[model samples]
Target: MHTKKVIIVAQLFISGMMALFMSGVMSVIHMGFTAQWFAQWGPNFLTAWPIAFVASMVVGPIGFAMARIVLRVEDAV
Candidate 1:
């Protein structure tokens, strides 16, 4: 029942935050928290954000459907 605009806005915010956190975590895991981490993370996050945005748009509906099915099954138990 959510409107398309609301869904898109939610996806934008969620993907932005997710990309920010995951990019930092993965970069640090790969290179540690070096002084160069900021420089490295900048481009890395930039690359990831768009991909994350598009991917979320693609998978969001499927994920919602799966969650609904799982929750329904759980409630039936």
Candidate 2:
């Protein structure tokens, strides 16, 4: 939890889970879950996780700002 807000926590969870599952499926699709599946997936997941986490951190606030303006929503606690 640390000092993370609700928004940040939600963003992390959503982005992380999405990336994990998507990468898993995509890796399997590319390699058919063969003997090399984890071997391949490890590298791919390692590459994707950081990018996804950083992207989520960067994009979440921007998207939230846009939504607030567009929908005239009050900032939530």
Candidate 3:
């Protein structure tokens, strides 16, 4: 099992990367590949990162549990 520190750090890295890419992609899709898209991407990433981090913390355990269940079922079969 991962330590709490490891989990938190992993969440940070995961959330940051996810937020960065998602913000850039959405900004481009909505605003087009222009100066405005570049302008919005940074602020959008800043806004999204924290929310993504919190959401990942909440959802991570549930997802892990579900994966464990699935794996166990496969093992039993």
Candidate 4:
């Protein structure tokens, strides 16, 4: 039980960190030093940050939940 909890917690943390990194990458690509170059590519570049951030927010929890489920199944076998 304790091990399961630790695994779940670790998975959640990893998923959150991955989500944050993806969001940050989008932010940097859209608003950082490359902003001018990205703008030249298309207007949609301005919208990528928010989209990636929101997607990450949704994906992280879902990923964590899935990881927990998989861990539980593995423990059962």
Candidate 5:
């Protein structure tokens, strides 16, 4: 198993990237590539990042556990 510090850092990076891309994509889909669309994405990302981080922290372990089960990777191994 990975260390808690490593998992937190990974989650921070993962959540930030996910929030950035998702906010941008959703903005584009909703408003197209206008000046306003570009303007909104930054704020959206800022708002989303924290929520994303918390959600990822909560869900990450469960998701990893499910993946390990599916892949038959033992935690002890």
Candidate 6:
């Protein structure tokens, strides 16, 4: 039980981190691509973290499921 908990925690952490990093990179790309149109859209590039957090929340369970599948496959091997 303790091992399972630890594995889940680690999986969640990794997923969250990956989501955060991807969001940041995407925000940068968006800013670059929309620089010309920013005058109309305004400079709202600082909203990446909240978006990342929400994305992480949404993705956490899926990530955990994938992790479990991989772990099970490894154990079977």
Error of 6 at 35 (Å): 11
RMSD in Å for model 4: 7.9
Better of 4 and 6 by lDDT: 4
lDDT of each: 0.91, 0.80, 0.92, 0.58, 0.96, 0.57
Q: Model 1, poorest ten-residue lDDT window?
A: 68-77
Clashing pairs in 5: none
Q: Arrange candidates by TM-score, descending.
A: 5, 3, 1, 2, 6, 4
| Model 4 spans with C-alpha error above 4 angstroms | 1-44, 73-77
Q: Which regions of candidate 2 deviate over 4 angstroms?
A: 1-12
Residue 2 Cα positional deviation in candidate 6, in Å, after optimal superposition: 8.3
Cα lDDT tens digits for candidate 4, 1-77 = 44656755665565556555655566567678575644543444334545655665577558767998987755343
Model 2 is weakest, by summed lDDT over 10 consecutive residues, at 1-10
Cα-based TM-score, every candidate: 0.88, 0.66, 0.92, 0.37, 0.94, 0.41
lDDT of 4 at 48: 50
For residues 1-77, could you state the per-residue lDDT of candidate 3 as single tens digits? 77899999999999999999999998888889998788888999999999999999999989988998987744332
lDDT of 6 by residue, 1-77 (tens): 34657755665666556655665556567666465544423233334445655666678658766998987744332
1-77, model 5: which lDDT tens digit per residue?
78899999999999999999999999999999999998899999999999999999999989999999999998884
lDDT of 2 by residue, 1-77 (tens): 13478767777788778778888999898889687897877777778877888899998779878989999998766
Model 5 stretches astray by more than 4 angstroms? none
Scored by lDDT, the top model is 5
- What tens-digit string does per-residue lDDT give for candidate 1 at 1-77? 77799999999999999999999999999999998987899899889999999999999978877998987744332
Query: In model 4, which residue pairs have backbone atoms overlapping below 3 Å?
Result: none
lDDT of 5: 0.96
Query: RMSD in angstroms, all models?
Result: 3.9, 3.3, 3.6, 7.9, 1.1, 6.4
Among these predictions, the greatest TM-score belongs to: 5
Compared with the true structure, model 4 gives a TM-score of: 0.37
